[model samples]
Target chain A: MFKNFFPNKILSLSNNLLNSLLVYLILVMFLGLIYSLYISPPDYIQGDSVRIMYVHVPSSFISLACFGIIGIASILNLVFKIKFIPLMSKSLAPVGCTFTLISIVTGSLWGKPTWGTWWAWDARLTSMVILLLFYFGYIFVWKFVSSFNKANKISSIIAIIGLLNLPVIKYSVDWWNTLHQPSSITLTSAPTIHYSMLIPLIIMLAGMIIYLLIIFLMKYKTETIKFKMNKIKNKK
Target chain B: MLGKNAKKRAILLTLLLLLSAVTIFLIFKSLEENIVYFFTPSEIYNKQNISFNKTIRVGGLVKENSISKEQNSVKFIITDFKNEIIVSYSGLIPNLFSEGKGVIAEGELKDKKYFIAEKILAKHDENYMPPEVTKALEKSNK
Candidate 1:
C-alpha cells in the first residue's frame, strides 16, 4: 500500500504538468461549486428544499459521465486492444458505483419529503438503478475473470450493450412525466434555483470531481505496479 | 520502488477522500438546516433537550378525534402504540394525513412533549395504511 504513492509517472510528472493539473482542478472545483450553489435561483415551489438539486444534479451528471468514459474505454480495449484502456474502465467501476449510490441515496432522501415517498419506481430512478446494476455486473465480470484478455473481450461487449441504459436514464425524466423531478440545468430551462444554494453545491461538486480524479490516477498507478509485479513473477 | 508507490497512493487517496468527505459534509450541514427529520411519538419523548424553534418529523399514528384547529394553527395527537404525542401544526398537511392513520410530522418538538409540526407525512403501504400501523393495531388488540 505504501508503494502506491510513488508511481513512476506520478513521480516523473513534470513540474509544469503537475502544477497545471492541480491548478485546473482547483479552478474547476471553485467555479463549478460557486455557479451551482450561489448563482442559481431557488425553485418557485420548493423554496429551500430546491437546494438539494445543486448537489444531487451534479453528482448524477458525474455518475453518467463516468459510465460514458467506461463505455469509451471498453471500446478502445476492444478495437485497439489497449491494455491500459480496459484497466482504466475497470478502475472507474467503483467510483461510478459510489457516485450512483450517492445519487440514489440523496435522491431518495430528498424524495421522501418532496415526492411524498422514500422511493418510487419512477422512470428516472428505475433507469439509474438499472445502470447501477450494469456497473456491478460489468465490474464483477472482470474481477472474476483471471484472463485479462478474455475479460476485456467480454466486458467490451457488455459495456456497449450497457450504454443503452445511459440514454434511458438521461431521458427518462425528459420523456416521461414521472414524479421524479425534471432536470433544472438543461440547456433550455433557466435553472429555477437561487445563488445561495448553487454556490455550495458547485463547490462540493468540484471537490468531488477532484477527489475522483486523484483516486482514479492513484488506482491506475497501483494497477500498473501490480501488472509489473505479475510480469516479473511470471518471468521468475 | 513498490513500497514508495504504494505509500504515495495511500497518502494521495487519504488526502483526496478526506478532502472530499469534509467538503461534502460541510455542504451537507448547511443543506440539513433546510431539511427535517422523522421520529416516532416515543422518540420525541425519549430525546432530551427538545426545542420548539425549528422543524423535524414526528412519526406515528394520528390519535382518533384528536385533530382540532384554531384558524392557522391546527393541533393533533400522534401515537406510536407506546406513547402519544401532542402536535401543533401551523401549515397545510398532505391529503392522506387523517385520524387513525400513520403519519410522520415534520416540525420542532416544543415544551418537552409537544411538537409544533410544519409538515405531515402520511405513511402508506400499497395504497394506504402503512404496515407498521396494522402491526401496532394487532398488538394493541391482542
Candidate 2:
C-alpha cells in the first residue's frame, strides 16, 4: 500500500525541507547568539567564559549524535542492503569530525580560564579523542579499500566497534574522578541550570541540529547524483 | 559475486573484531589507575604509607572562613565534612575559587595534613561541581 511513494517525490520534499530549514537554522542561530550574549546572565562562578557552552555543548551533542547515526545506518546498510544508507553514513563522518574538532577547541578555550589549564588526560577528554580517531579510521577504511562491499563491511564494523566509546564518553565523569564536571542536564531530572540559561542552550542546540540535517541531506543528494552519473558513464 | 567474496570478508571481519577488542581492553586497562585524579581528605587521611612528597589532588568543599590571603600565596582548608586538610597555593586562583565552594587542588603534601597546591581548580558554576568532588562528598557524608 505504501509502495506508491516515489523516490523522486521524497527527494524533492527533502530539498524543500532543506531550503526552509536553512532559513530557520540561521534565524534560530541569530536568536541563540543574542540570548547567549545578552539575555542569559553570567554564571555565578565562571561568568562570561561560561558563554562558550552555547557553542561547545551543542557541538559536542551533535558530534556524539553523528556517531550514533553512523553506527545505526551502517547496521541498516549491512542487514537490509540499503544503498543510500552507506552514503549517508559516509557523509556524516566529515561533519561529525568537524563538530568534534570544534568542541575540543572551544572546550580548551573554556577550560584554560576555568580549569586552570587548557588540557588534561581526564577521562571525558581522553574518550573524546578516541572518538575522533575512530572517525578518522572509518573514513580511512572507505578510502583505502578498493572493493565497495569490502569497504562497506569493514567501515560498518569500525563504526559499530566505535559505539563502545560513546557510553564511556557520556559516563566517564560519573564513573571516574576527572576534571570534567558532571552533566547539568539529565534525562530523568530537571536541568540544574537556570531557566534563562537553559532556554538559550536549547535554542542553540536546535539551531545546530537543523544545520546538521541540512548538511546531511545535501551530502546524501550529492552522493546519489554522483552514483547515478558513474552508472551512466559505465554504460557508455 | 557476493558469494565469491564472502570467505575473504568473513576472515577480515573476525580479524577486525579481535583487533578492536584488544585495543579497547588495553585502553581501559591503562586508564583504570590514572582515572581517579582526586582523593577526598577522608580518603587521604585514612591511607597509610602515604608518600609525603608525591603530587596528588585533594577535592572537597572549602571550609568557611578558612581562606587567608598573603602577599603572594593563599591558604585554606578543604573539607569533606569528615576530614579536612589545609592547602596553600602561591598563584592566581581560579575565578570561582572562594570559601564555601567546591575545589580541587593539585600538589604534593608537606606531611600528611598540609597540601601545597601548585594548581587549583574551583567549581565552574553553582550547578556544576567536579564529579569526583560530589562523589567524595557523598561518601564522606555517609
Q: How high is each candidate's TM-score?
A: 0.55, 0.84
**Per-residue lDDT for B1-142 in model 1, tens only?**
3366556654654464457556645754675323223556676678777666865666667899999979988888888788888888777676556787667666777665677766666653212122444467679999
DockQ, per-model, please? 0.02, 0.27
What stretches of model 2 exceed 4 Å from their correct place? A1-17, A234-236, B1-30, B125-142
Model 2, span A1-236: residue lDDT tens: 12212234334545557789889999999999999989887765676888998899999999999998898777566656667678779878888989999999999999888887888878899889999999999999988997777998899988988887888899898887778898988898988877778888999999998888778667766766766777798899
For candidate 1, the per-residue lDDT at A3 reads 40
Docking class of predicted structure 2 = acceptable
**Candidate 2 per-residue C-alpha lDDT over B11-130 given as tens digits, one digit per residue, 9 for 90 to 100:** 565576568778876887786756776888988899888888788888888999999999999999999899999999998788778888778999999876899999898745338323
Residue A43 local lDDT, model 1: 43
Q: Which of the CAPRI classes, incorrect, acceptable, medium or high, describes model 1? A: incorrect
